[model samples]
Target: MSDIVLLNKHQKKALVIELYNQGKTRRQIAETVHMSFKDMADIINEYTGEDKQVNKPEKSKDSRAFELFLQGKQSVEVAIELDMPADKVEELHVQYWRLSKLDNLEILYHEAEYSLSLLLRLHNILKDKRITKDKDISDLIELANWFTRS
Candidate 1:
């Protein structure tokens, strides 16, 4: 019998990648990580290939939204510029830009940006570790909470 360890998202991904490289079965890795078989299969499917359709979102939409946000445009301005509704822009802002429960809205954006960079670093590292799937979502949330704490 193996011990069940509560891993953060980064750690889970790292473990998966390492196990994959060692030629472990997805089922075995799932068992080791205390995940469901279905989740293990999904993770293997997502991270194991270069031409993975599940991995890529539309580039232009992501890039344009990011670019507009970076240019210091207000969500309303962004909406007009991008020909999207203001409400939709607001949705994007809330989704992509973190909204703080305390302090000014602008500060929240800056904080979110910094935190996002940290998450991105972890994400890339995990990618190198070859983690796939949204299976380890709990761990990911845990990691994100850790990011906020730090």
Candidate 2:
């Protein structure tokens, strides 16, 4: 492959990030972008985070979530249609975005859905005469505080 002579450092950095996100190996990126291994390593370290370097292995496109995503369905729809747990749907959502490079993160939908579900559950438990014990109340408190900012 020919060396990229006209590319600036900024352009090289962007290329590195794009290649990294596409699951290219360090050597492949360096060679493609015409950088020495040291230059490539420094760019990867300085311009990117550990999370950027991580890529889930590609799965077949036959997944229901994949089909839904291709059809432009949002997270809440995908979750409901598949009847999956929030965490699994979120995981698939993350993977889908990484591969597709689309800015389609539906965080608010998860938060609203989860919050409403939790609230309804809490309301049911509060009205239950069986939850008269302090332990159950403590568990409820813990559940209410499940997702606080660290």
Top lDDT model: 2
> Which regions of candidate 1 fall more than 4 Å away from where they truly are?
1-4, 50-150
lDDT string for model 1 (4-73, tens) is: 5689877887788789889998778987887777666666666876455666776665468767887777
Q: Show the colliding residue pairs in model 2.
A: none
Q: Count clashing residue pairs in model 1.
A: 1
Q: All candidates: CA RMSD in angstroms?
A: 24.1, 17.0
What do the candidate models score in CA lDDT, each in turn? 0.72, 0.76
Worst 10 residues of 2 by lDDT: 102-111
lDDT of 2 at 133: 75
